[model samples]
Target: MKTGNKIKLFLVDDDAVFLKALQIQFMENDDFEVETFSTGELCIQNLNKKPDIVVLDYHLDGIVKNAINGMQTLDKIKETNAGIPVIMLSSQDKIEVAVSCMHHKAFDYVVKSETAFVRLQKVISNIFKYQKMEKELNWYMDRM
Candidate 1:
């Protein structure tokens, strides 16, 4: 558990306005330390900061020509640190899109909507809970 520390969050989206809005909302909460990136490449480059979680847009190629999409970025993130949980964000409400993200090892998928922030908050809570449980389980197993 992070305890007294704020969660390090990486927010990536090509939509400047939307990105700023999301960043603002998260920044309002004292529990998050957020960094914004306009492209998946930039996010990848800054992986050294070691964000606890990443909220990545599904379509990152909107602005940059030939920019890598979210899936590619997700793959790179997983390759770097499989344990870091990534939550995919997209305007696409299709089940297939969500399933595809899950198949690619996304921790969760959030569709952009009126209630997106609430859903993202719940998912983040679950991730911490799961991580704590896993850590405890590992500790017990080591004792055995």
Candidate 2:
């Protein structure tokens, strides 16, 4: 993954309006290529595209009564590709929920707010920055 390339991101949310807003926010930046999905199943199916990050809504109660939630989706994604970063989002700010998401290897748990998009952008940047640092360290170690 070259830093020169735009980061491909997958955002899964059942809320149509919120999903659209997230897509718009991420797409506005030239550094990101955003893909939106209404269900976690759909997003997981498309992981073959190898997105850099995933933004998943905690509750995926679409038309499907048995739809998988964000934590379940996070587990599925981690099982597929542990390297990909997944950030869980929800309106509920319960500590147990956040802790559960973290236990499932979620990169971050964000509660929905008016400034959620702004915070998301920062999280994305931090992930990329940390990845860059890790890659650089590995390169140096290989040379050693």
Q: Which ranges of candidate 2 are over 4 A from the true structure? A: none
Most TM-score-accurate candidate = 1
Candidate 1, lDDT over the whole model: 0.94
The Cα local distance difference test for each model comes to: 0.94, 0.91
On residues 61-86, what C-alpha lDDT tens digit does candidate 2 reach at each position?
A: 87578989878889999999999999
Cα lDDT for residue 137, candidate 1: 100
For residue 78, model 2's alpha carbon misses the true position, in angstroms, by 0.4
TM-score of each: 0.97, 0.93
**Candidate 2: C-alpha lDDT:** 0.91
